[model samples]
Target: MKRKYNPHGLPPWLRSIRNVCGQFIVPICIFQGIRTLILPSILDVLLLFLLIAAVIAFQFEMI
Candidate 1:
């Protein structure tokens, strides 16, 4: 039987490293949009923070 594809959807709560990292992609993209609209210089700092948040999220998910 063919299964439905769910490339972007995840369970409500993060359950794994891939889940956490994957879920973050869209928000990071959206945040970039908002940041660029306000201040281009802030994008770099925002991205750095996103990276740190992503690392922490991944670490928690791994536990």
Candidate 2:
């Protein structure tokens, strides 16, 4: 059987950083999405992709 992951096992500062990233990543992703839609630059698209991946990683606690 696999053991469940515990977030509380992380350091306080790391948890706070994760919390901050969780709070801000959504707005940044939204803004990047709008920018990508409007301008559609390669760099912007790549950045948006990375930001989205980060959001997913955060969601899954894979970061």
Candidate 3:
């Protein structure tokens, strides 16, 4: 059987860190996106992609 996921199952410190990251991930994604648009380097694009994925993961509580 598949078990349910619970955010409270996490330790206090880890949960706090996840909360902080969830709050900041959007702005960081925006900044990275703008930076990628202006600069368009390979690394910048890669970073932007990673940041976007992180945003998705955080939003869906898949992290």
Question: Cα RMSD to native, each candidate?
Answer: 10.2, 2.4, 1.4
Highest TM-score: give the candidate number. Answer: 3
Ranking by TM-score: 3, 2, 1
Total backbone collisions, model 1? 0
Q: TM-score of each candidate?
A: 0.38, 0.83, 0.89
The runs of at least 3 residues in candidate 2 whose Cα sits more than 4 Å from the true structure, single-residue gaps closed, are 1-6
Better of 1 and 3 by TM-score: 3
RMSD of 3: 1.4
Q: Which is the winner by TM-score between candidate 1 and candidate 2? A: 2
What stretches of model 3 exceed 4 Å from their correct place? 1-4
lDDT tens digits by residue: candidate 3, 1-63: 988888999999999999999999999999999998887999999999999999999988988
Candidate 3 matches the true fold with a TM-score of 0.89
